[model samples]
Target: MRSAPRTEHVVQEAYVMSRDYIRYVTGRAAKAAPTVTAAALRHAGDDLLAKYPIFFKRWPRVFKAISSDNACDYLFNILDQHFQPDKPWQKKELTWSGILSIYVLAGQLAIHCQSHGMECVLEELEVRVGEYMEAKVCPGIREKGGWSGFVERYAEKEEPERAAVRACCGVLLLLASISLTYYMYRRLR
Candidate 1:
């Protein structure tokens, strides 16, 4: 006889569906806003935010959708409504969503700074991210011995993503490097 569906499994599916529905609703709201002219966004800016998967996976598409319009407001909406710090990743087990969302926010700030011709935005963003990680991520992630211990623990995992709960930043950095190098090579030619 086939085993009946487990209650836990059913609950998890519902939870995930709810999160997706929330995302869809907010995405609709973002779409309703006025868009900026192409001329305005052609100036471009750094994409430091794309380093983080969660936001990178979503924000750039939203940025494109509105033609770089209402970026700060959109970002705030993303942070306050979409991310919702209280949501707790995947129903309360350990995860990186909160801290990483803050990192992505810093990257967004950096992009805003670059577009506005503000100086030292990268440095400022780095400081903010570092402070945030220390304040938020370290408390949960650090082990008995501290940060190094946490690193050693995660390093032993056969699937780092399973332990870390996000795709490896090292791999993303390497890919970004390759893409940037190719772009620069083409530009010089």
Candidate 2:
């Protein structure tokens, strides 16, 4: 039987993978609608708070009584509840969007904890989130051809206005670089 990987190495690998995935998702070609990126997941979390203001209002008061372990449990439980509201047993069968939303919700929970003076939970939260994703979501992601498939499926279809803006920006950047080079050449002469 294979021995389990060291916790430290697993955590580091997860961190690297997460960073790369986020960079890939965010750096899609200009043709992609901006809403397809990770920012949309974060905005979903923000929308969650807006739709259910009671969670925000009660967190500080409830946080005072939660132990570190229980806090993580509570956070995951909330995520599961939110994502699998109708089918509790289907918690592990999250879609790609659901997987991403869990990550965003975890991040939002960390920020909420930090803001409420539980700064030390950040590292623990990171580890917990990594562990949870590896155990629960990684298999599904692999089955889907991973991040490339995610980007291909979700990142495309731009409006004409966004394409126009991107074209203008590219032209302006090229002109600015040429102008800077000419100025430098003149100064050196």
Which residues of candidate 2, in runs, are more than 4 Å off?
Answer: 1-65, 80-92, 152-159, 165-189
Positional deviation of residue 18's Cα in model 2 after best superposition, in angstroms = 6.1
lDDT of 2 by residue, 69-170 (tens): 577888777765665546555544657667656665565566566566765666666677666667656656656655554445444457899999999999
Query: Tens digits of per-residue lDDT for model 1 on 1-189?
Result: 212222333222222222222222223223321222111111111122334446455554555532233444454555546434555665323343353344445454545445555434344334434433343344454332233332233222346557554556667888999999999999999
Clashes of each: 0, 0
Clashing pairs in 1: none
Candidate 1 to truth, TM: 0.31
**Lowest summed-lDDT stretch of 10 residues in model 2?**
24-33
List residue ranges in candidate 1 displaced over 4 A. 1-94, 143-189
| 161: Cα error in model 1, Å | 21
On lDDT, the candidate that comes out on top is: 2
